[model samples]
Structures are given as C-alpha cells and as structure tokens.
Target chain A: MVESLVKEYTGKLPVKLLGELKDKLTAQKINKTRAKKIFETTLQEYLDAQVAPGEAVGIIAAESIGEPGTQMTLNTFHFAGVSEMNVTTGLPRIIEVFDGRKNIATPMMDVYLKAPYNKGKDIRKLALLIKQSTLQDIIKEVNTDLMNGKIEVEILSAKLDDHGLAQAQLKKILEKGLKGVNVKIDGSLITLAPSSKESNLNDLYKLKEKLKKIHMSGLKGVTHVLPVKRDEEFVIMTAGSKLKEVLELEFVDETRTVSNDIYEIAENLGIEAARTAVMNEVFKVINAQGLTIDERHIVLVADMMCVTGGIKGITRYGIVSEKASVLARASFETPIKHLISAALTGEEDYLNSVVENVMINQPIPTGTGMPKLSTK
Target chain B: MPKVDPTKHILVPKHSKLSEAEQKKLFDKHNINFNDLPIILASDPAITHLKLVKGDVVKIDRDSPTAGKSEYFRGVQ
Candidate 1:
C-alpha cells in the first residue's frame, strides 16, 4: 500500500517531484492492522466454508502479524503435517504490515490448507475450486469464439463437433481445405502443392501427423521444464499457458487438468489463443465477466503455462523489470494499478521506469529516498 | 431448495438401527434431533461438493477395512 511511503523532503526539493510523491502516497494506503486481519479472515473464511461431515476445521497460526520491514516467514498449513502446501504460484501471498512506533510497513506472505475429501477443506481447496471454475468459464467463452467464425467451406466446418473430436475435425478440415485446391492424398503418397507454386501443406501435414502420433500415444499431458539458475543451483520453475489449445485437444479435459499440480499458465495462449474467436470480441467481457480472480491464482495459471510450454519467464519478458515478480504474483492488478496511476498524471514514462527498476531489483526512486540528496 | 418428502428412500437414522426401538425412544426422549445431524457418504469427498439439496439423503456403503466387511446405510432422511 502506498500510504506508508514517506520521505523527509527538504525545502530545496523540486515542487514537481514533491507533488508527484504526495499524489502517489495519497492514492496508496498503508494497510497496517487491516492487512493482517484480511489475510487471517480470508484464509479462515475460506476454510470455514469447506466444512464436511465428520471433519473438523482446525485453525492454526490463523492470526499472525509479521515484524515491520521483515518479510513474512513462509508457514504452510497442512493436513496433519504431511504434504507440503505449495503457494499456488511459486511466489508467496503477501500483505503489508506496519510498525506503529516506527511508522514503517513491510509485506508478509501467508499460507492456507487442503485436506482429504471427508476432511474439511482449507484455503488451498477453496482457491483451487475458484481457479478451476473460473478457467472453465473462460474455456466456455473460448469455445463460443471458435464456433462463431466460419471456415468459408462447409467441409472444413463439419470437422468440428460438440466434444472429443478436435483432432479428427482438424484432420478432416485440413484434408478438405487442401483438397483439389493444391494437394492430393493417395493412400500414403501425400502430394502437397503438385500444381500450386507452394508446398506449405506438406510441412503442415507432417507437423499434424507428429502431433497426432503424440496424441494417440496417450501423451495427454505435456510439460515444459525450465531450470532457473539461482546462486549455484538450477531451480525448476513454472509458467502459464493458454487454456484454449489444451481444451481443444479433445483428449485433455480442461476441468480435471486445471489443478494446482499442473503447470498450466493461462486460460488461453499459443495455438489456443484463437479460442477468443468471436465471443471474446468484446474486450469488456474478459475484464468484467472474467471473474474477480486473485492475482496468485493467475500466477499459478501462468506457472502452468510455463511448465506446459517449457518456456521460462514470459511474465518477466512481457512485464517491466521492477514490477515483473509483483505483476506475476498479482497478474493484472499491479500492472493495471500502475497504468491507471500513470495515466491519471501523464507520468507514464516515469511509472514505466519504476516498473523496470522493480523488476530488476534496483532501489525504487520513491522508496528509501534519493542517494544524491543526502546531506553530509 | 427442493421439497422434502417423507416417502423418499431416506437413510435410516443411526438411532433406528441401534438394535431396538427403546434406543430410538431414549434418543428422542433426550430431545436430540438425530435426523438433522450431518451424515457421511461413502464417496471420498461426499455430498458437499455435489450441490445436493438440504433434505437429500445420500445412500452410503459403510465399510470396515480391518474387519473386511461392508454394509449399505441410508444416511438420515
């Protein structure tokens, strides 16, 4: 929260910088006591709502406030202390805690739980259920988009159906679309562009064959592994991917696969991006009806994308340096917040600079004050 | 909420299968509503996630792993 940001600006400071800082601090509130309460209550309420028959809902470390300026210790609430509770995203869920006496606030990470079916559910289960339902809804939108677009040929369009026929449809569509137009399929001798000036269909057919082979081999799940070089060791990392492609695969059930265990990053990405088709033409629906999703959940989705695609750090590349991790954790909110703040004051470049710095771990201009302004 | 019917195949309350009518009479004498108590389904996660109505009685196959025996129980009506 911004309200906690305070700098002892001397009288000699420029009025412009001073005004900008004031406006920013005014916009962001220093959520001291409330942040902890919110974290505790949200986690607790999430667990409470999951009461099952003959199961007990236990509350441990439910109300805890981290020391000011200190990062919250990673505490996992588990099922009788067995399975390590993953933080949905690789990153922790954080909230700012203020030191009343020192007037300085710092962020802290929190954890939740998930037990067996007969046992009461925890925060993790609630979050997972929410995330799955949300993605399923998005998939519906994507499917709607795919349906609205006409393939220009009835034969190609006929390839698609209600469920479990994507590959069959795609193969049929490809065959129909490339018929006497440019290619010929005689038994196994596939003649691609025997008459046309191009033979791109040959390559497309080969690729499709490979994908079909992999699919038929029961390779239902594909994981893209990325090892991040941290210190001396490489850490296995996760990312998000588009949900549309996985859903369209017919073999892959979008609902069952949308679990914390899977490294699916986005509701739509890569070849699946076309799922937005016609239904998602209204951008407002993606933003408004797209569910008020938690930033961590989105990051988890992003992690899945990274894992499934074997790509590393799409968030880092697409988002600025200073704000990359935060944006990855919170996804849309952090970026939207900064963009809105910048837009309101015509300081878009300055905000961009801040984001870059944050991404790269550089000292922010607003926080901890300026190094040059020190009085000897 | 769907309408609650007494005729539907509801799970016999635990008290009803307690060996005799005297036990059920005693439980009722104590002013405890056994029918309103939560019941467990044999399904791993159970009826909570199924979006079942309030009065729906889920049939559960109760099993004892150690005893190697199982019996069907109609959860409370």
Candidate 2:
C-alpha cells in the first residue's frame, strides 16, 4: 500500500525524501487514508520552498555571503595543535580559493591510508617514505680537495638508516646522477672524482653543490610529513602537496586523500572536485571564524565559478569579464580597454543582464521586469 | 600517463545522460530550453568516461547536506 502511494508521487517529490517518507510512514504504522494526506502536505510544502522563476538569486547570494565576509580575520597562520604545522586559514585562505591562484601560500595534503597502514603499523615509516629526502640531510661533512680535483663526504649512517635507505643504493644514485664524475665509497667516507684529468677545481667545486641536491628517496614536493592520530586511525599530514604521486602509492587511501591546493585538485581529479573544494574551503574558513552563512549561498557561488567547465575566480579577469554584454564587461574593470576592444570588433550589447539595464537607466530585467505582458 | 578512474573518485557523483523524452520533460517543467541551462565542457575530466557530444544534457545525483540527495543538470558545450 505504501509502495503504491510513493509511486504516485515519484516525479512530484525528490526520490530520496520519498523513500525516507515511506520508511517513516511504515515505522509509524499509519493507515492508507492518513498516509495519503501526509504525503500531500509534504509535496505542497516542498513546492512552496523552491525559488520562484525570475528571482534575482545571484544578488541575494552575493549579499548573504558578503555581509559575513567583513568580520573574518586577516590572520593566515593557524598552529595545528601538537603537529606543529602552519595551515592557512581565515581571510587569506578565502581569497586564495576564490582567486583561483595557481600557487597557494601553504600547500598541504592529508593522506589517509588503507588497511594496516591506517591501523598505525609502520605508519611512521610510510610517512618517511613519502617525504622528500636529499643528500644534504644524510651527509655528516662535505669538503673539496683542490689538489685531487675531487669532493669528499662523510655519511651519517644513523640518519641514513632512519630513512631505511641502503648504502649501495646511495652509491648507485651518486654514480648515475653526477655527470663526468666517478663515485667511490669506503666505510663511512665517500668521494667524487672528476672523470677527466684536464678538469679544473672550478668544475669539481660546482659538482659538489649539485651532489648535495641529488634526490635520494621519497616523492618529490612532499617536504615534511607528520603522522597524526585522529580517533582510532593515523593520517599523515604533509607540508607540501604532490597529489598525483601520493595517490598512486599502494598504502594510500586514494578516495579520501585530498590536497588543499585547488589547482592541483583540478589538474589531477577534475573540475567538479575543484568546485566542491572551493565550497568546502570557503565554508571551513567561515566556520573557523565563528561566522554563520547558509550553505545554499556558498553552493551558488561555487556553481557559478565552475559552471563553465573550469575554475574561474570572481576577479575582473575571471567570471566578470566573460559577461555577454559589452557594457557589463566594461563596467567591471578597465572600462576603457573593454570599450575600445568592443568598438574595434563592432560588438553589440543586448542588455539582457542586470548590469547593462541598470547602466541604461531602464527597468532592470529581473524579478517583476523579467516577464512582459502582450495584448491579444 | 596513468588514467584516472572517474567512478572511484569520491568527489565526483553519479552522472548519466538524459534521454530525449526525459530531456523534453525537464525543459517543459522548467519552462526553459537547452540554451538556458548551465554548461559543462565535453572535455571535462569528471565526465571523460561518459563520452558525451556537444549538446547533450547530463544529470548529476549529488548527495548534499542541505537537501539530502539533490539533482543537478548541465548541458555539454
């Protein structure tokens, strides 16, 4: 009986809400006649809640979010408890997200692991494996011998062992990476000699600098890692984001691991992911500052920004300049430039949007003005 | 380059193409046409697996906090 009643309202009400309503009616053990009455009222209420046609939702959403935006703090640094990580928050983060800036101030990633990795078994080792380790980090001392035209270095085995890197692997990397230089390893001491006898000390000295920067192990761009305990699971919080490489790791939970860099997410995941990131990022900043704003407003902004299949900022060079009307684009910023370009192209302004109509001192085509009456 | 599995990503939702009958029904209900709706590029990574043409409409099943499960639509451009 409940199934038939829900089927009748299938197209009228949302499918999820209808299912919930059916479950609720079944749990209450309501009769057929009364259940029909309840369903009717709910359908009526939902229809009433929807926004009407010709409503100026854009302006309303702008005002709703903009009003609370003024109270946000300008501070960017937030000390993340015992982790000793500095995360960008508040107004600066909000700007970073909306600007669609390629390079963010503080790039970060929270890497969730799968199975045994999340269970805290060898989690620290996994963190070490993901962090970028350089030759400078494991070397005890580096010196140049001008007479021999070579560079000598003393390795710190303890530090090397902590990274779980083998001496043979280090030697192999040194031999492959350094050009025209032969690498020799004796106990804890290592030496790099120029392959050509005619080579001067200047060439050997430059090779010493290059040797310090050789990537030893771990993924590139992941500078620091800290395994943080949240509830019963351990998640690694990285200081820098290398989302594509990190997601490929066997231990990483690819579905849940996320990067704070919006551009990185778009480049790796998709625009929809970036859209959600923008909304979540903005809402997070707003919530942290103890400000209240409706989710609908943020959703509207995010949808508008991502509607064109790519992320565009709210700046003059972004969504605003792409408006259809020449007057609208000109009015936003750099008016003279837009006007001249439009004139050169013989552009026409339809005055369909709010800005152009208002510029012409006419009835703006929004709300009451959207619909026109024609006599028969 | 490694191919991304669009279906497995958590950020993306279930997207399906609307048939001609369903598309007409949606347009009639909203009192709008194809040009009136928002657009998504054919090259968008989110729908790379869908293999959509230029003017097709896609239906997105979004699990939202405010409205539970909500529906969003975009036209391919």
Candidate 3:
C-alpha cells in the first residue's frame, strides 16, 4: 500500500512531503482505504487553500489586519495582575509591530523557567534577581560637599541585604563603572572624590547625579520583574526586555521564553525566532482586543519582515523603500524623493509589482494577468 | 554545509529547492513565470542550508490550519 501510494505521488509531490503524509497516516492507524480517502481530502484541501496565480496577497493581508485594527483601543493596559508592567496593546501595538519599531514603548518578556524552578519555587527571589536594581534603589541618601568637591552616597543597609549585594561588590561596581573619580568605601557609606585635575564643585554635583543611576545588581535594562502563576506554572513578566542576557540565566527555559521586542529576539535567537515573535506579538495584541484576524495574514506580514534576513517594518522607510520598482516606492510615500533617487541611481522600474502596474494603468500581473500567451 | 534543524521550530515551513527540470515542470503546470510566483530571498535561513543560487525555485511544505499540510513554491531572489 505504501509502495502504491509512493507510485501515485511520485512526480506529483516532493518525496519528503509524501513520506511525511505516509508517517502521519500510519501514526493515525487508519486502514489503507481510509488512508487513501484522507490523503485525497488533504490534497483537495491543500489545493483549495492555495492562492491562485496573481492573487494580490499583500493587499489581502493589509486589509485583513487593517480592518480589525479599527476596533482596537488606543489606551495601554496593565498586563493582568502585573501592575508595574503596562503593555502597549490594540491599534498602537499593531502599528508598532508593523512599523518594526526598535525601541518599543513597553518592552517586556514572558520568561518561562525550567523544571523545578518553574514550579512552586521562590518566585519572589527570582523576580528580585531579574529586576535591575540601581544604586539609587539601595542608596539612602546622596549628598555633595561643595567645599571639598566630594560626593557622598549612604547605602541603605536593609536595601543592600534585600538585594543580596555585599558592600565589597558595590565598591567594585562603583570603581569599574565610574571614571575620573576615586571611590572610597567606608562600611555602608561610599565617598566619590574627583581624581582628575579639571574636576571641581560642578563636577562633584554631576558625579552625584550620575552615581544614582550606577548599576548595582540584577540584569541591566530589566526595570522590573513580576512573577505570575499561569496554568500552575510560575512565569516572570518583566517590564524592560533584555532577551539575550536573560536567556543566559541557568534557570530560564530558553526555548519557551520570549520577548515582545522583535529586533532583540532577532538579534539573540535568529531571524526565524524573530519572525515567530512578530506573529505571536501581533496575535497577542489583536486577540486582546477580542478581534480575530487570520493567522495567515500575520504570518505573511512576519515573513515579509524577516525575509530580508532582518526585521524591516512595513513603514515607507523600511520595506516600502526597499521595493524593487521605482514606481512602487514612489507610490508609497514621498514620491518625489524615491523617483529622484531612482533616477539618480539609473534604477530601472520593472513595473512587475502590483503598485507599479496600477500606477501606469496596466493590468496587474496577478490572476489572469499572471499568464502570458506564447505561440510556438 | 550544516543541516538546518527542522525540529527547532514547528511553525517554520520546510524549505527545499527543486531541480531545474522540476522547476520547469512546476512553472509549466501552473502556467506562470518565475517572477509571477511569490518570492523568498536566497538569504532566508530556512533555505540557507540548501545553499541555493539565485533564480532557484524553492518548495515550501507548510502546515496549514485549514489544510492539514500544503505545498507552496517561491522563486529565490
């Protein structure tokens, strides 16, 4: 039966696809006749779902996502019980995802933990470990002595203990991060004196201000971390996103952990992961608004973004400007700029794309326009 | 060339480049030109493992919600 099925699909489909179908049917434990019926139905469904030649898929995708975007709210919402984390959702998020904004309004991460760590582990401790606690977080007071040109920072003993930071580590951090200053650690009180010849009273005040933002502990760029229970598993919801650094943690489930920032994901996990992130992020925002857009549309959009080996937003400056045809780019936005640039570069307008064809009032090379009659 | 780990993601469609004869047959059967088909870049990670040259036709086996599985073709650019 398998041999016969192979013979039937020999030239019709790829070998790997046929093998996969056979495996699927065999796994389902279907009888030979039943398998044949299933295979036929599957093939029919596949053919039916396929876009006909010249279908304006880009337009369809745009409309599919755009129409539902109208129903989306403009307001940002708190991520469930995670009060500290406000996720940018609705129409704004859709725009952000499509635009492929690098620095998102509220970059967050849903960090899943591995094994025992994901269970009823010390979630509070984990949250604290991920939250980026600066010197200001642990400092009781910061003062500058104008006369002596020295800055004094009194560390809160309790805050230091709470963050699990030793005085020695804090001193090291200060010494390494600070420049043109001498760090003098006297118990919980640290003093910064300018070692540079040009330093004065004004520099001391500036140093005091800069000292407050010095990295003390936890992952940098991660502002806050809130551990929430979802489906009986504890997951960390972070305010700021640092996917690469966070994934390096031993307890983190790298496969499942994801960030809202597409570029960061692309940079860390590769373009394929970024593509998935784009789709997931788009779905999340759209789904939150109680609107159902087809996943295929989002998939197409994500594919377009990552197809160039990097994420490029749907904005005019991004994917639009990169369009092959001069007229297509001109039609998008700032037509004169694109036209002039193309002219200067001696770029040829193929007029192959839908927009370029439409611009010149020619029949689009899609659907019936896709085929050209050739007589031999 | 290092093989692309297909098992790394279930969402990404499987990509394979067709031979010259297979590509010609597909274009003829579909009554379409290379430019008429949707495009996937030669740099696409999914097909990068294949080390496909420019103008090669890539066959993608995507798992569809409506259809159990479907085959789509893109001309590599």
Give fnat, all candidates: 0.00, 0.44, 0.03
iRMS value of model 1?
25.8
Candidate 1 lDDT, A1-376, residue by residue in tens: 3323223332323334345545654566536465435434544554566434332111111122112104333443332222432222101222101100111111111111112321332322222222212111112111111232211211222212222234444445445544443333343222333234443545444433332232211112322212233344322222223333333333222322221211122122211121111112112122333333222233233322222212222243332232423433334345677656556766534323243556668765442433346577
Worst 10 residues of 1 chain A by lDDT: A96-105
lDDT for model 3: 0.79
The residue-by-residue lDDT of candidate 2 on A169-285, one tens digit each, is: 888988888877888999889988989879987787789889999998888888788899988999998888999888888888888898988878877777778888888889889
| Winner by lDDT | 2
* TM-score of model number 3: 0.77
In model 3, the Cα lDDT at residue B75 comes to: 79
Write down the TM-score of every candidate: 0.20, 0.91, 0.77
Task: Give per-residue CA lDDT, model 3, range B1-77, as digits (tens).
Answer: 23324325433556777999998999898789888766666666556678888889888776654445667777778
Winner on DockQ between 2 and 3 is 2
Candidate 2's iRMSD: 2.5
- Separately for all candidates shown, the number of backbone clashes (residues 3 or more apart, or on different chains) is 33, 0, 2
